[model samples]
Target: MELWYTEKHTDSVKFSIQVDRQLYSGQSEFQRIDVFDSKEFGRFLTLDGYMMLTEKDEFIYHEMMVHVPMAVHPAVKRVLIIGGGDGGAIRELVRYPTVEHIDLVEIDELVVEVCKKHLPQTACCFNDPRVHLHFEDGLRYIRHCEDEYDLIIVDSTDPFGPGEGLFTKEFYGNCYKALKADGIMVNQHESAFYADDAIAMQRAHKRIVQSFLISKVYQAHIPTYPSGHWLFGFASKKYHPTADLNGVKWNALGLKTRYYNTRLHAGCFALPNYVEEMLRDAE
Candidate 1:
């Protein structure tokens, strides 16, 4: 028998993956967690029925999220990751010798445990001594700190359920308050092709623009995600992701990546006309 997993990106659109087998399924206090094995994607993790990471293409999302900012600001020593329970971001950050410590705040501990059990490709970095895991609300965890981390990555799910607060203006303000003068924040800005997801993307970009001095939006292609066009919000007090980007420094690292390179960093910031219009209207 053939088993498949389908997620409704919108009411009229659906994406499906054929599964080799079901590895895990259970309800955490926050949301439903599931893991499956597939021929194309290998092992994958989904939260509340939305795809999070798959072994085959996880590098694209993780690398773009971690490398873009690090290359822009290599002196970034301490980092904060909010809601990246799969640990893919941590895995990428750990590879940079300049990064000293990483604080990962995940609202649900079960997501971490399940990833460790079934999705170790992303979860394996948790064992590194530089990481400190906090099982608490990321919104609340960020509110009490000031001038702490040099970088903060809001690697959240969609703008509903457990991830609702992450897109709020108040939360962006708090993130602004939590960073140093040169801090940069990279967030899970939603997709631009669909109307529903576009609304979330606009609101998030608007709030970040209001909170930070320099805000830029970048793109990545993730096939499992809606529209296969994904965006990441880059907000900072000083550095511009492109102009201040140390391309030479990043290239000298000699990091071998599947989706990211110094050239793509500049090219990704070049938005399509419709996307440029959409972001301007977001202003």
Candidate 2:
């Protein structure tokens, strides 16, 4: 008999995966988090019929998501991460010894518990002392916070249900205010290949341009995500993503990383011609 696992993504959505003898399934309040053992991707996490991360290839997603901003501000100390309960972003942030504090605001506590229990390698940094966990709405939390952070990493979900407010202009404006003078905010800006997401990027870019002096969208390849090409939005009041790395020390704690490095730091910003053309069209 063929085996198939099914999970309820939403009232209107469901996800299923099939293998020779194995079946895996789960259903979230909004999007079900399901894990499957695939030969090509190893262990993969899927939400609402969409792939969020894969074990063998997670480094590319986590590294590029974290390091691009860390490298931009080599002296990043106080950092804020929104919706990164799996600890992938925290794991990468702790690599820089200069970081003294990190606040992670995650809406769903269940995602954190599930990842920590079922996905150790992906959720290892949840136990890190420097990282503080606050289960709440990130948008509301940042608005009330008076402490200005050096870096704000928006490691949230796709814009649909719970994470919809994260992409709003008012949220972006609050993020700009919640940061220090030279602070930077990085957001996962969906896929360049997705026509629907292009409008989302344009909207975010418009908001950032009005608030921050420098705003740009960068691309990374994430196999698990839709379209396989992901976008990241960087907004800074002072520094550019590729201004100068003259005497900066990255991965300062002798941390071994699979994807992010000094060379990749510069190379990640090198966008494809099509992606560049799309951004140009937006302008």
- The TM-score between candidate 1 and the true structure equals 0.99
Pick the lDDT winner: 1
Q: Which candidate is the best by TM-score?
A: 1
lDDT of 2 by residue, 1-283 (tens): 6655454434454555553332346665656776667555566665565566767778888898888887777578899999877778888888777799999999878778878866676799877788899988998999986538999999888787778899887898899989998899998887766566667776666666777788877777775565667888888878888875422465454667777777767777888888777767655
Residue 70 lDDT, candidate 1, scale 0-100: 95
Task: Give one clash count per candidate, in the order shown.
Answer: 0, 1
Clashing pairs in 1: none
Write the residue-wise lDDT of candidate 1 on 139-234 in tens digits: 999999899989999999999999999999999999988999899999989899999999999999999999998999999999888999999999
Model 2, stretches more than 4 Å misplaced? 1-29, 246-248, 251-253
Give candidate 2's error at residue 195 in angstroms: 1.3
Q: TM per model?
A: 0.99, 0.87
Whole-model lDDT, model 1 = 0.94
CA-lDDT, candidates in order:
0.94, 0.76
